[model samples]
Target chain A: MQRSPDDLTLSGDEQIAGEADRPFARSLPWLLLVGGLVGFAAAFTLTVEKIALLRDPDYVPTCSINPILSCGSVMRTPQAEVFGFPNPLIGVAAFAALAAIGAAMLAGARPRPWFWAGLQAGVTFGVVFVHWLIWQSLYVIGALCPYCMVVWVVTILLFWYVTLVNLGRTRAGRLLAEYHAVALTAWFLLIIGLITVRFWDYWSSLI
Target chain B: MAFKSPQNTTASGARAKIDAARAQDRRRAARKRNMTIVASLVAAFAVIVAVFLAVDPGSGPDGDTLAAGESRYVRSDSHRLTTAADGKVTLVEFLDFECEACRGMYPLVESLRKEYEGRVTFVVRYFPLPGHFNAERAARAVEAAAQQDKFEIMYQRMYQTQTEWGEKRTPADEYFRGLAQGLGMDMAAWQKAYEDPATLARVKKDVADGQALGVQGTPTFYLNGTLVQVQMQDDLKKAIDAALAG
Candidate 1:
């Protein structure tokens, strides 16, 4: 590892090049592969279920477990097809690409600057879109879709990791990398708290 | 082997001392970095949670009010559970008779209408979803009953016996006709009106009006012309009480 002379810290010990290829760092590619695959499968299933719903007006989706968690209720609304087509079409394409990229990373492909930038952009859009959906689900349309929630979780993790990788050698990014799990744990807790509080009545009844 | 010579041993000893010093330095740097990162991350997490809580929809009193058009929602011929001549608050409900959710809210609304009998004018507008088999015909039955001045009676009976006839996925016209006779309605007149375009038109008009008002589901409530976010009974009661107070 090469150290920059001007980048010396207060302790004056070499902080090194912060090269991300440490032996333990190899596990990140594997995590991405698994997360991407699960997300792709979920998005694909939601799209297929959407087609089934279109074919039959009375079709109750597999994800329609209850009133609170029904894809059927969500699908009938305009928000489900915001772009004049089902939103899952975008998901199916995006997640499939995400899974393919994850597989390439697992195969030891060191992506270039443009590749990392592309991943960052894709995930940034996904995070924003999912946040909007979370707001809509809790406030506007007033329902939750199970497959959509799966996509939301995976997308969040994917975005977080992608961002960490894109930050390169910055001090902030290095700090983030060292405590990646801590950041992820906080994010998960925040979202879970939001959902629990939003549907407190229904959730409390289950117990 | 090189250290076997005295000259090389001196060099090797100096190198060993330097390597030990570097190792100690690296360990200290690692400790410092790890601690700083953890502290920074915890602080970042706390700040994020605080900011989110400040703007969270869960904590905000952001009401989901519908922009109902300029027209007053209630038609002169619309169904009324309680008709108060000078009632200040009008609770408009867009409902489907066969919807299970409507059935669930039936007793609740019924009790409220009775409790606030003279204070509120409770109106029901037809909004029969295509999926429900008996919803449209039930609307017609209610309309047919309305012709004989027994709208309230038939409304109660239909809801009271909803489970017996609802969600059958088959026509329940004959059963509804039986209900009309039981309600002491003019059976012949009710039968003619059942097939009359005017009665069907009456029901369809209410549905069209509901659609115009942006009603997309059963049991959608418009209290005093604003959509009330029905999270709890207290929330709804508060809206009604506000409307009545005004």
Candidate 2:
């Protein structure tokens, strides 16, 4: 008996999902792996060295040249503490969670609904923190924390990736598909340019 | 022939059910998206509240004087010199007499003193930035007035009429004479005090004290003994609340 296109159906044995799912699932693994590695390394380095460097006055190991570029000057000030605690502790916990998330993604595990929600929460936190740190560095402390700045960059990238992936899985997939790559690249360049302009004086002084 | 017709009918029925299921899935996804947007907005609001609570612990029962201790001053001397008595919150200002920023901050300082009254004390210190040529001489003229208990009047008048006296048009001695007349100082005593080398040394000492406490620029204020780096009103309030709590 002949069948129409609407009526036709593959047998259970012949059914297979498309390559679209395969690529989409695999993309996350690479992102998580790289993000995890970078986050772990950056967090570990800052946690170990930056805190110790702050407590010691005579142990300046370069990087403290101009008044504005001086990490020692900024770190020594009371503005470094938001709630009587160093903000980098938040960074350590956040990066650690990101690394765990990345590992889970690498294992081919589909995140539960709560996992996506948690990720969205984290990205929001990161966005707030990055802007706060930038404001403090620019107008308040008038000096940048070198290692903390690196963490800020990585956190922003990780946030962008998480947002894109979440958007792709949800009903807003079309919006994500249209602007994800362009938005990410544009943001990356904008931040890099801002940092460059901020330290222009230090660069010129060296030259 | 009858079985063939029934089979076609069943096939069409199954196809219709499948289409309906897909449509339902699309509606469910849309609902989920709407829910997520609502949840995200709620979460954003919660975060803002949390941040506010985290930054400002609130003003306790101690009132404005306790709150004033947390305000950012330009330098520690501004606080130390301004406090009328031990345990009192003070707003100390270390200023260059010729600094434009200092001139601007003068009225704000005056208003704060009036507003806070006995709860806070306002102390003025000389911190002439080396870049301004006339700042040192201007600082000395104010110190000379302070010898006769007219420093505050002269200090305010110098800033009020900063354009006439602070810039290069008028000579330092001539400006001092003008300030003395405006403040109703005894001219003979004012002239003798203005020329006193000791008065200049006292102004120099205030500048030295400001530098020792990390005063980087003019119009620096010290709330209590802590060096304030930011000048925003909310930040100042937050610091004051924290100090009051302490």
Q: Using lDDT as the measure, which candidate wins?
A: 1
Fraction of the true interface contacts (Cα pairs closer than 8 Å across chains) found in each model: 0.03, 0.00
Candidate 1 at B71: error in angstroms? 39
Candidate 1 lDDT over B135-230, as tens digits, reads 988988988888888888888888888999998976787899999988888899998777554465567667767777788898899987788777
Give model 1's TM-score for chain A to 2 decimal places: 0.86
A106-178: candidate 2 lDDT, tens digit per residue: 6755665577679878878887777877777766555666666667777787777666655543436546534
TM-score of 1: 0.51
C-alpha DockQ of every model = 0.08, 0.03
List candidate 2 stretches off by more than 4 Å.
Answer: A1-25, A61-70, A169-172, A204-207, B1-246
Q: Which stretches of candidate 1 lie over 4 Å from their true place?
A: A1-25, B1-246
Q: Identify the leading candidate in terms of DockQ.
A: 1
Consecutive 10-residue window with the lowest summed lDDT within model 2 chain B: B58-67
Best by TM-score: 1
